[model samples]
Target: MINWLQHAPVYPIVVPLIAGAAMLLLADKHRILRASISVLAALAQLAAAITLLALAAGAGDIWPKGVGVYLLGDWAAPFGIVLAVDRLSAVMLTLTAVLGVASLFYSLARWDRLGVHFHSLFQFLLMGLNGAFLTGDLFNLFVFFEILLAASYGLILHGSGVARVSAGLQYIAVNLVASFLLLISIALIYGVTGTLNLADLAVRAGTLGGTDRLLFEIGAAVLGVAFLVKAGAWPMNFWLVRGYSSASAPVAAIFSIMTKVGIYALLRIGSLLLPTGAPAAFSLEWMFVIGMATLIFGAIGLLATQQLDQLVSYCVIVSAGTLLTALGMPGVRLTGPALFYLVSSVLTTGAFFMLVELVERTQTFGANVLAVTLDLFDLDDPESPNRSDDVVGVAIPAAMAFLGLAFVSCALLVTGLPPLSGFVAKFSLLSAAVAEANASMQPADAWILVAGVLVAGLAGIIAFGRAGMRIFWGNDERTTPRLRVLEAGPVSILLLLCVALAAGAGPVSAYLDAAARSLDDPSLYIDAVLSASPTRAIGGH
Candidate 1:
């Protein structure tokens, strides 16, 4: 049992892979069995993830530095495949599990029947996501990147609509280009360093000659472009809105985390492979500029769009921009709060995506009517006593009310308004930024970040307000769209998780603070991975 527990790192990847493969064997008619397997597999992955989080948090004496290094085939690090889990990876794994459960549960309502191999693709996506989060080597990272992208291509085109097909093709084309760049970057790095392991790369980063360093920097820049495209940063995020909005609700919800995977790669690789000081901080200025541009662009898109799906998609871009700006700054203080904000924003964004479909089901006709009404009669009905019955004192229907409340919750959460985790997250982030500025006596880019966050939050508020009024308040012809328990259950679960994160912010923030500190000091991670060899394992670091 002790030996088996040591292999826990691989289960997050292996369980989903096996379940997905098994699901492939089942006939399409066996929907019940496939769904059951998918749910159980997701639950098992969640359990394993939680256990790993606990272990990485120092629940036992296995690792004293809050890091777990698992070597495959009993092979040593810098030579064999390794899965390294720390607080950050554990958090990502737990997040993936939560999303997997939510997305799978929501799909059971109707999405599972719309396509063949839905469950199999879903499981494979989870496997790929978990593998990407846990893998400690760049080669495996690229492999997992492809795996997830392949799975996503299927998910995006699951419903078989024209919009989905067109958007899916564009999405696939863009990622394929990114993948090619990823391969080129990896090849350049390997040619220079002669190693693919992240820890070994970090250990060797400081020893590169001038020519090798230049080559490595170019490779890193190419890699950054690929990651930025996936992360939905400006000038490279042309594929994000169309692809996400065209996808089905559950698929879009899950794809919310896909952008973060790119951000995670940027964060992890930047911290691990780059040493401290001037030469190491390449392209950060460019990242900051592009991130700010993305934030404002997303804000404008959110306010300009009438479609709820597009609004949610823009919110994702804004969230990514916020994180990029925070990370672009130099300090663990801001990075810690940024990490917390990342969790809150991603959860809210996912919940909003799921809610959009449910809300749209009832508002479709009403929205069309309102559009016509606005076009004919412009700004002259405020005091008209002969107003139609549809515009006056109509009681909100049960479904409308429920959706309205959920929309309000999502709005507050997305806009960083009061009485939610979103507010707490933004407040913490801004406070840290202000504190950092005052401490240094040179504000530099902190003010720009603060402005970007505030303006973006305002844009979210305006967009949600416009959308909510049109859907729930403006139209009196309310039809109660049948709400399935499975569909509603997953949205509720995701929202509750945000509430729990808010309620438990102290502990979570503390943990993230430690994680940020550990990230800043890469030696802790490097020493942990490199010293985990059998010979060194007998005599610990």
Candidate 2:
């Protein structure tokens, strides 16, 4: 039992793997049992994640480096696969689990029935995400990336409509190219360093000759491009909106974290591979430029989009850009606040995605009515006194009112308005950026970032405001959408998480600061992973 407890880091990966395999063996007629198993596995994974987070943060004397290293098959570092859990990985694991729970709960309403093998695919996706976050080596990272991508392919095409199929094809094509690039980059790095372990690579990075270093930098640049495409960066994000908007609501909601996976890779690899003053330091500047461009583009897209689902999709791009911009800057001050913002933005965006499908149900009647009236002119109502009384106020239905309130909450959170976690996050991020600028004599880029953030917030507010007016206030003949407890419960839970994050900002900020500090200094992670003893068995087998 103690040995099993020592192997806490792998449970997040193992639980879902077993659950998915078990789900696959079950027939479609056993959906209820499959769903029960999936939810239980997800909950178990969440518990394991929280436990691992505690262990990584130094709950017990598990390791001295404030990192948990689990070596597979008792193999040592740079020789075998390993799972490393630091504060950053722990946070990501917890976030993934939270989103997984919410998405799975929402799916129970109707989404799971829309397609076959949904439970199995959902579990596999969780396994892939958890594995990606926990893996300590680049090789295993690629393997996990493939796992998630494969699972995502199935999820993206689950419902199988013409639009979904078209988007899935585009998404698959783009990601295949990305996967090829990833392989080339990995091969180049391996050729130069002769090792795929991140810690070993970091240790060997400083010893490369000029030519080898140049080759390595090229490889890293290619790898960054692969990650940026998934991150929904400008010029590389054309597939994101369509793919996400075409997905089922629960799938899209969970996919909100998928972009963050790219951001995580960028942050992890960037911090580990490119120390300050290294040859690859130039890449950070390019990252900043791309990030700013992505932010501006997303803002414009958000304003231009009419569909609520598409608007939420653009917001994901905007969040990615914000993270990339903050990460591109120097120091952990901005990075810390940016991490907090990541949590807030991901939660709110996910809730908004789920909310979109619910709200659209109410608008179908209004939409059909307008479609029929589009070709017919309303010439009879120009000067009639009876037309004045036709504008009688309609009382908002209880369900519509509830959805409107939820939409407003999501809007406030997404747009960074006051009294919400979004506001707190952006305020913290801008404050840190401002202080850094003042310290650095107020650089032009810093001020530009400040303006960009405010402008993006303004764009979100206007866009969501217009969407709300149209969906809730524009028509009095709207039907009250049937609100299911399972569906509404998940959205409320996610939104409540944002509120809770705001309420507990002080502690959460401190935690993120610690995580950021560890990220900024890779030495801690390197020493932790390299110094730990090899596992005595494969996950205590």
Candidate 3:
């Protein structure tokens, strides 16, 4: 047990795998049994993730043997892929676990109403997420992505609503193309490097030159397209708003994890394979261009949307774009802030969806309930006995007030407003870009980024103002019910988390700083994997 804990980087992945299998077995049994098992499993994984983070945070570098190659059956990486838990991967795994548990708990807070199948699909989704984060090989990443995507297909269309089904199909089509591209890109990379091990590829990628560089460039471009689509950049973003708007709140919460995987993969590849010094590697400039376009497009799209949920969805696209833009900045040391902003954005967006669910149940914001309430409040008829359902009129004002608060939080997080973690993150990235600009004597890109930041801020304010006015002060007299307990608890918890992140930005930034430093220098991971005792190296290396 001591040895396991000491060499415990792989436990995060194992816990979810075990939980998924166990949940699948118990799915046919009682709902309480399934919920208990799923929640316990998610929390257990969350605890393990916290432990891993704490360990990684304190330790100088956990992997010392070239990316902690944990060969599953004692085989070396060339023959068997290995799992590496460096700072970036560890932190990401921790985020996944935390988000998974939070989402699971939110779902359990209303299990029976959501259906039993939700639990099963959710468990599988968590498993896929854990695997995706921890996998050391590109092929396995694709496999896990498919598993997660298949589960999401079920989750997205779970209720069989017309809008959901229609939107889900579009989501499915987009991802299917992405999956195909992912496979083709991996094959080309393997053809070039003769290995799928990320670390090994890192070592091998340096040898390519001339036409080989062009080959690599083609593969990288294809791979980037696949990930960018998943990231909801520009032309590919329409499906995200449609699918997310129609999804259940819990489904939306789960969907929140998907794009993060894409962004994480982009970072992983950029850091590991496309070293800054490698001439064969493609530059990050294209990533920046796409990210900027996505930001502008999403902001405009949000301004055009009338529905509250759809507006938030487009904001998510904007955040993804910002991260991409940061990545594209030459010689920039902004990865830390990018990661921090991504985690924070996911937290707040998930919370917003929770709030949306509550508002949907209320009359003031309920597009559906508005119809129901309209018939009840038809003052033109005195014989109407619907006065009993006027519970909505009294609650509408309060619910809309809370909705206003949530909307502000969403804007702050998405647009990087002051006194918020979002702003801190954006500031860090821009500072890095400015420093790089000064060093390289190229000020135009820096100025463009600054302008983009200002425009984004203005767009966020205008969009939020429009949404708030329509949601809170609109003259619509539709009476609906009050915010339910199910909606209030998750939203409250998430709001507190956002507050905590904003207030304690110093410590959080420090942690991200360390993690960022670790990512830039991966020698620690290399040492850890190669330092394991022969007896404990389960897979032969």
Report clash pairs, candidate 2. none
lDDT tens readout by residue for model 3, 1-541 = 2456544656766666666677667644455677787788778777777766666665445443223445666555655756666566767777777777667766654432333367768877877787777787788888888888988888887654567789999999989999999999988878887877766667777777877767777787788788878878887777899999888777887677678888888777677765534322235777778888988887788678777788778778877887788777765267777777777888878887767766565444465643433453442244643222332333334666676677677677767787766777777767776776677766777667767766876787888777667656774774444654545566767767777887887888778777777666655554454443444455422
Root-mean-square deviation per candidate: 8.1, 7.8, 5.5
Model 1 ranges off by over 4 Å? 276-283, 365-397, 535-541
For candidate 1, give the lDDT.
Answer: 0.85
For model 3 the local lDDT of residue 285 reads 73
- Which stretches of model 2 miss by more than 4 angstroms? 276-282, 365-397, 535-541
Q: Residues 1-541, candidate 2, lDDT per residue (tens digit)?
A: 4667678989999999999999999986676799999999999999999998888778877755678888877788888888999989999999999999999999886667666789889988999899989999888888998988999999998764578899999999999998888889899889998999989888898888789988988888788888888788989999999999989889999899999998998888888866734445335788788899999999999899988989999999999989888888877779889999999999998999999888877877533532333223231345632122222223334877779889999999988998999999999999998888888864777777899999999999999999999888896767776667888889999999999999999999998999999987899988877876664533544
Candidate 3's displacement at residue 111, Å, is 6.4
> What lDDT would each prediction earn against the true structure?
0.85, 0.86, 0.70
Residue 44 in candidate 1, Cα distance off native in Å: 0.7
- Candidate 3: RMSD over Cα atoms? 5.5
